[model samples]
Target: MQLTFDADVEEFRRKFVEFLDEHMPAPGDVTERSKSSAHVPDWARRWQRLMFEHGWLLPGNPPEFGGRNATVLQQYVHLEELSKRRIYHSFNPQGLGIIAASILSFGTDEQKQRWAVPILRAEITAALGMSEPGAGSDLAGLRTRAVRAGAEYVVDGQKVWTSGAHDADVLLTFVRTDPTAPKHRGISVLLIPTDTPGVTRRPFPSVCSPDDLDFNEVYFEGARVPVANRIGPENGGWQVANGSLGHERTLLWLSFADRLEDLLGDFRPRTELDRDAYARLVMDSYALRMLGSGALAAAARGEQDTAALSILKVLGSEASQAASERALDAVGIEGLTHPAVTAPPPPLNIEHFSASWFERYLRSFAGTIAGGTSEIQRNIIAQRVLGLPRS
Candidate 1:
């Protein structure tokens, strides 16, 4: 069966297209150098601010939160259109997509105004401080400690693979608040300013490229975060962490299908094997979109299927990696010759798709690892969906 949106959703798409036509930045407005750098460019910040002012930055949010309170399907369409064009609403993905969402979900009214609004409006950027050296996939095992000290929580630990921390204003840090409690129960989230007296960030290059210095190792040496900055109750950070991750995975799973679609559109198959592979990739992209649509439908009905989300995460990530591999193969050795040391620009950059096939191929591996690893997703699917016992 053909997948399609109803008339109302189509109308929403039409208006959104009009908005884009009027406000979308001209090529060269956001330079390739800026897109590749860790710093958020002035142009990007302005673009995000414009979208927020127009109620298109996040269409599902209320007007005060940079949205028009659009329907869930309309919101999906908004994201799909932007993805099809390779446009990102915010340069800070974790800020807008995950941390801000978590703050809005669990933060008090005052906290929402203090953090979420500025994030949605692009006045400030945030980084997720979830993963550590020992707790990449299994967040429950994170060892970062935050001991309560009067009106402040003294943070002392390290966070690895923290994207954009070097340039971010704040880090939504997860720390062990109660060591005596169970692993998952003792966690808490602290919005620690990057410039705090004891906070230090060291930028690190990813395997994708040496110039890709987006990831950082952040150290907190007796960093004193105000108790008022704590999100959710003390030792109640597990729930906040789950909400944050859920927001991240949900956005990522949908974006993967869009990225695959873009890849398929740009790919030119040469041989019979290439042709077959291209066809399969196209089918996989379609399947992912269908699955995403089903998930959206369920959400609209006030139903949530965590298993379906896991399956989407696995399929979408693997399909993206496979698509990138096939593209590299189609181009043969020449694909391998693309300069690998330079940072890969954002997808909106014209050169991003053309000159960086090798970079894209390397970066595709991150999709599988981020949000949750493929192995972790499979275990979740087996236990939660199939009702299988833990291995």
Candidate 2:
């Protein structure tokens, strides 16, 4: 089936393109890159704030939350255009996409005003503190503990792989509030300020690049967070965590699709083997885009097919990894010596796979592991979609 938008949505896209042409930042204005995924530079912050002011930051939310209550189709078009252009709505993606979305989904009116508004407006940033040293894929295995004492909860534990924690203003942290209870039942989430007396963050470099210091290990040594900071009911954090992960996985395929499309557009095969690989990647990218469109259509109809989301996640991420690898392979050893390695980094907002094939290939590994590993996603698809028993 051919995908097309109605007249109003087309008009919306036209207007959005015009807006970008009028206000998009010049390349020189955002030349410096922190090389970290989580840090937002001055120009990015200003760009996000400007979009918020114009109600383009989140077109589905109310004006106070930087939206015009645009239709679902309009929001889809908006995101599509931004991804096609490799523009970042927020430099702190986890803060805007996952944290703010979770707060809006489950937070009280007071909490929404206190936390989500500033996030959408780019006034302050947030990070998710779920993965601990002991807990990576299995969140129920986490060991961090927070005990209640009068009006505060004294927290003590270590969280690893807490991306952007070093630069974030706050962390949506998960802790075990009732260890005696079953593993999943007594979990809870807290909005802990990163600057609390007992909180510490140590950033570590990743394999993607020596300059790309994005991952952090956070320590909480008797950190005292007010009991009022708890999100949702105590011992009900599993539900909140599920909501956050669901939001995180739902639309992430769009970025992978955009990247694959970009790679496919620029590919020029040098040999018979290269042509065969390029053809396979093209078909895979086409299938992924079609699946994404179908998922979006279902969402617009208010039908939640979670199994479809799992399939999209698996296909989109793996396809992107394959495409990046192919791009690097096609270049042979010379790919390793691209100028991006020695040159000052390209502006984060405008650069895509074209930035550096080597860097892109290294960074692609995180895509499989980030939201959930490919192994976990396959198990989900097997059990939920294929009617197979859990192994």
Candidate 3:
């Protein structure tokens, strides 16, 4: 279901739409090419510079720290507009959004100056190295150790599923600083340069397809980082990690609108076997969009309901699955058969959609698994939101 906006919001939408239409990189161009393994594409960096020059890359930070200091409503409006156009600047994500935000909230002034400007200007890119092979959802179990020396911390551990690490200039990594302390208490966050000695990156094949590029494994062996690089207090990295995840959950869920539009395309199966199933799909998609906007509104108000995020994570994944399944059933033989030809020229060509549907289906399957699994979300909602007793 579509929604009506207030006049002011409608005007914001108009400008946003116009900006994206004018500035967004064309598909199949150099800007659209997928980089090697979790690497930042050059076109994406150019796009980030464009946003920086336009003063839209990161709007919440102070003007001194490379942000527009836009209001929360404006931020929501901007994000919504960009998501609608499937436009996201890749290079500035770390410096402007996560890393810079984290630092501005906690880091020393010198640290911010040294790091924040370059990130905002698209000069440096950073990847998050939080999930390890043995520890992903259960972050407390992370075995990566950061042993402190006189003035540096020597990090030695493996981080799995480190997205965009290969092309990143730095890594905001979480490690255990004090094993003796309780699980979550002893952890620390470090901003380690990827070029630091003993840091290695290896590509991991995608579960869905080799053509899909993202995901990587990182090994840190005596990866030395200055003590000054720590974002928050030692053993208090959980808060930083949680904060990053909170932001990520919101951002990831916002992408569902694009998924919905992709499902609504012409090649979508026309045959409706069950009226109830079709109705359920339509209703669920509507609900997802409404809840997404509601979440955005709340976030703009400086309030984020994790329960709402959890519900959206689970429901949106299910909705994506349902839409894909229904579309496949609708397309029948065509769905089963792989595309044999390249897409034709502009507006008419959507072969990318066809090629990506199955991959998206499999990737969305992990949506429930990534931020927090469905089981984890259910427990969170039950215990935190519903105030249920732990079993």
Highest-TM-score candidate: 2
User: Which residue pairs collide, candidate 2?
Assistant: none
Q: Write the per-residue lDDT of candidate 3 for residues 1-391, one digit (tens) a residue.
A: 3355567666765765776678876665542454542345667667767766666676555666545676666666777766544455553354456765666666788877777667766678777888888887888999999999989999999999886787778888899999999998999999888889999988767876576445788999988899999988999898988787665676566666556555654333444564556667778878887888788778766896889888888888777777766666655565545541235323212124446445545656665676677888898889888999999
Candidate 2: list runs displaced more than 4 Å.
339-356
Off by over 4 Å in 1: 32-38, 339-351
Clash number by candidate, in order: 0, 0, 0
**Each candidate's lDDT (Cα)?**
0.85, 0.85, 0.71
Q: Per-candidate RMSD vs. true structure?
A: 2.7, 2.2, 3.6
Tens-place lDDT digits, model 1, residues 271-336? 999999999998999899788878888887778788898999999999999999998988878787
lDDT head-to-head 2 vs 3, winner: 2
After superposition, the stretches of candidate 3 with alpha carbons farther than 4 Å from their true spots are 1-11, 14-32, 36-38, 91-97, 300-302, 332-356
TM-score, ranked from best to worst: 2, 1, 3
Listed in order, each prediction's TM-score against the native is 0.93, 0.94, 0.86
Ranking by lDDT: 2, 1, 3
